[model samples]
Target: MSQQQCACPKCDCSVDSQAIEKNGQRYCCEACAIGHTDGSTDCGHNCQCGK
Candidate 1:
């Protein structure tokens, strides 16, 4: 089967993947799916998000 290109639900960006389901739901990347939840944190062990 051929690959499908779709836009991210959080951010409008093209993503190529062959595993997309028929629901049209897709995530460009794990980072994008995570979203601003991490933005509040500093990405360090001291970050509250990690807690």
Candidate 2:
């Protein structure tokens, strides 16, 4: 199956098989799923989409 992009509008990372699902949306990490509540855009990955 093809990987899906993160649900976050600013995130360009791809969601793997273990993608984090929140409210029926798939995210690359918790930060994306929570809409960067802490004002942090880092998803513990290399990409700096939220920067």
Candidate 3:
């Protein structure tokens, strides 16, 4: 089986086995999923720089 990858363009984190789906796009987490919703770079978090 092939491992799935995060659909977030600003993020390169892998989704591993389970991928968070939002509007047909896959993400690693809720932050990433929501961030990419508006096509903005803001991930609603202050962990990673410019995430």
Candidate 4:
């Protein structure tokens, strides 16, 4: 069986699977999901860097 990995949508850190949450169609850890600094931080993906 494949294991589930919890990666932070912001920092891409290894999140504890138990602390992950599903918001809309995206998955994120509590901190990044709700704790964004005015939506800053690039998340290293392609999200607006809150500029």
Cα lDDT of model 1 by residue, 1-51, tens digit:
444343333343444553333344654444443543555332222323212
As a whole number from 0 to 100, the lDDT of residue 26 in candidate 3 is: 75
Which tens-of-lDDT digit does each residue in 1-51 have in candidate 2?
699999988888899889999999899988888888878858888766666
Q: Pairing residues by index, what is the TM-score of model 1? A: 0.34
Q: Quickly count the clashes in candidate 3.
A: 0
Give TM-scores for every candidate, taking all chains together and pairing residue i with residue i.
Answer: 0.34, 0.81, 0.57, 0.30
Candidate 3 displacement at residue 10 in angstroms: 1.5
Q: What lDDT does candidate 1 reach at residue 37?
A: 54
**RMSD (Å) of each candidate, 1 decimal:** 8.5, 1.4, 4.3, 6.0
lDDT of 3: 0.63
Candidate 1 residue spans exceeding 4 A from truth: 1-10, 18-24, 40-51
TM match of model 2 to true structure: 0.81
Ranked candidates, highest lDDT first: 2, 3, 4, 1
Give, for candidate 4, the lowest lDDT window spanning 10 residues: 1-10
- Across 1-51, the per-residue lDDT of candidate 3 in tens digits comes to 466766766565666557778898777777677774555554444335133
* 1 against 2, candidate with superior TM-score: 2
Model 4 clash pairs?
none
Local accuracy of candidate 4 as per-residue lDDT tens digits, 1-31: 3334434433544334344465542334443
